[model samples]
Target: MATQNPPVADIETAQISSQTAQAGSTTGSWANGAFQKLKSNLVFRSKWAELNGAMGDLGTFIPIILALTLARDLNLGTTLIFVGIYNFITGAIYGVPMPVQPMKSIAAEALSDTNFGVPEIMAAGILTGGILLVLGVTGLMQLAYRLIPLSVVRGIQLAQGLSFALTAVKYVKQKQNLPKSKALGDRPWFGLDGLVLAIVCLCFIVIVNGAGENLRRGCGAAREGSDQRDEDGDVEGRKSKTARVRKIIFSLPSAFIIFVLGVVLAFIRRPKVVHEIKFGPSSMEVVKISRHQWKRGFIKGTIPQLPLSILNSVIAVVKLSSDLFPGKEFTATSLSVTVGLMNLVGTWFGAMPCCHGAGGLAGQYKFGGRSGACVALLGVAKFVLGLVLGSSLAHILNQFPVGLLGVLLLFAGIELAMAARDMNTLEDAFVTLMVTAISLVGSSAALGFLCGMIIFVILSLRGWTKDKPFSTIWTDRSTPEQP
Candidate 1:
């Protein structure tokens, strides 16, 4: 039966080839698509989105904490101006869109137990920014990052997380007290009350988690069946599912609802402490500094902090390169040049020293931000918040019960810290921990970086580790003995 080759064989071969081609095309498309999406979505388009999202999440809370800590000690108006100017300059220049609202730690330093006013701190930030700009321009910043190792960075992150967590706990305890001064002229501690509130909040979070799980399961089941349909239909179905998920995750309405609930809870509790906190004005006078003060601010701010800022910038470039280009050598010197230039541009207008803000970047990625658009959206939103809130937003935050703010901040800090867990290797873990520790312990991020680098070098030299260098590494290994 010389029935030549069966027609089925030909068809089978053709199908196999088609499948291979389809797979190759899909993989290529996905790679291109993810990159394109990242560039356009988060970095470019979502600047305003990130800004607004962060503001709604914890941007507002950060400033308020600073205000409360410094209210009795500093000129609220002056502090507001300082923060506003710094934020404006940084946002305009570095394109890193993080909210540089006043930090609680800075406020604590300036307030001291004794009376030292906002002017000093404002002076400090201005000085820091100026120094950072100069260093960045001069290329000192790059050197700093190169010196630090991955282990130190990890440590720093871990320490920072702990500090943030402790801060949250302190605030929660403070929130429980009655507004009235105690017999000893000290504020009453509300530790017990805070614990209860924390529990309740946790319960609420749990409920939300359950609801989310149910929603995901339902959606997945729907998608699985829908994919069996015609090609066009499946595509449309997938789009619909994506949109639904996004709506659930980033919907302003949902946030508003939570906010409203918070407000209602506040009213019902009528926490007395809210009334005691001094609030800043909704508007602030823009003080034009005399050239002498400006010069002083620049000198004082930039000179001391310049070293740290540069190091931070270098670390940022290294981290970004590793993430964006795995298994590829990235030039730390080039990254330093780019960041330094950006910092210089930012400091011209009194902006905060801008760096990679690894924590912020990670959060954006987790939240589905992909491109520059996402980052840009964040910037726009921050600008708008600054404009709309003017100065009063800081005050409004102070008026909220401390417990409420504490809970919110606690979650945010945890989220930021959790990013460290993503670093799989021991060396990476060490870097994060060291960076965090240095930032917290020294209260100087730059110093922490320096310490981290020393550790990394020691580990590397011992041959206990193997990781690519940010710049380049040359090694002399004894030639293997001839076999």
Candidate 2:
């Protein structure tokens, strides 16, 4: 009987080991198969430039989306899926590196509270979207676009751009208010995501940007060398070698590399995050928005969001797209229609409310996003992450190095701000600067917009064109000898 008991125990242990090994093998095989399929399909599929371009807007997207996810106002997976679909659809339709960003005003309002009342956010989004859709379909958006001065639009862009830059700087300096994440509030200068690391990343980006110019120069130099070879039969030497090296370096995706490095660092810092990941997507639910929530959402979130979306999202984005892609005709109506539809469908399911933004567009374009493929691929990545990782991404994102993000955000901000450079005239500059200043000072885009409109109206009424002097408003004969 004792010998039989020993055999039974041994058999049970063996059975347990076999089951564990089989389970492990099944998971390993599934992962290997997926990776193999992906690699096979990507042989001729994803271009390095497009892949690089795909990460361009992530600096802006990550912080906002992460904040919302942390606050529980937005579901990480649902938001990603919705925004991902939006990106893909827009990419296919617009064929440009179009941007879809969280509605900043609503996000701000929601994030101001502790829990952010998801229903309120949804209500605000639905209302705002409905209004935008009405305006777009009826051509009222076009009318609004025509009414707003270019200077005012540029002002909003300048403000948003500069604001992004300032926030990014804070993120880099590690002085941002986030005391919970990676000693950021302490402003550490020596550790991972420290000031030193940030500076290095910034320098790398500069070199990468300069490398493109160098490549151009190198190509020209190579051509010259070719010509010289043809003329004098001289062989190319150091310059050609340098050009090839620079090309190789630039071929390495700058944004993606840094981003991946940050993510890797995060995982290294917290290995147990692997165990936290669940296999399935987060559960999606229909949020219950009460009448009270709707009213509150309207008053707090919608009112503020409406002006920002109308001006920045629709008007400024249209202006920017035209300027950036001169041949592309992006209309305010189309933009409004898209924004309206995005929220109308997604927010009810607790997805983040989103809109177009000039800053995001400029940032993406400034990086490497020349075509829709950049964002389309980005969208696919987002959808996969959503379906696979779900809210587990929150922990990873929460751990991502803020300093690296800051460097990305800084460049994006500068790129967006550069768009305002075309307004070189005095009156236009005055309007743009004032709008930006007031917006930053008041912390209110609506207020700054009002101030900008007032200034523009006064200037327009006073005949404040380049040739018209301020003193000439009352005088039939104004002084013009100063030039």
Q: Of the candidates shown, which would achieve the greatest TM-score relative to the real structure?
A: 2
Candidate 2 residue pairs that clash:
none
Question: Against the hidden reference, what TM-scores do the models get?
Answer: 0.57, 0.82
lDDT per residue as tens, model 1, 17-113: 9999999999999999766644433343333333323333342334343444335333333333434444444333333433343333334443342
**lDDT for each candidate structure:** 0.46, 0.80
lDDT score, candidate 1, position 77: 38
Off by over 4 Å in 1: 1-52, 56-97, 103-105, 113-115, 173-197, 203-257, 263-395, 422-447, 464-483
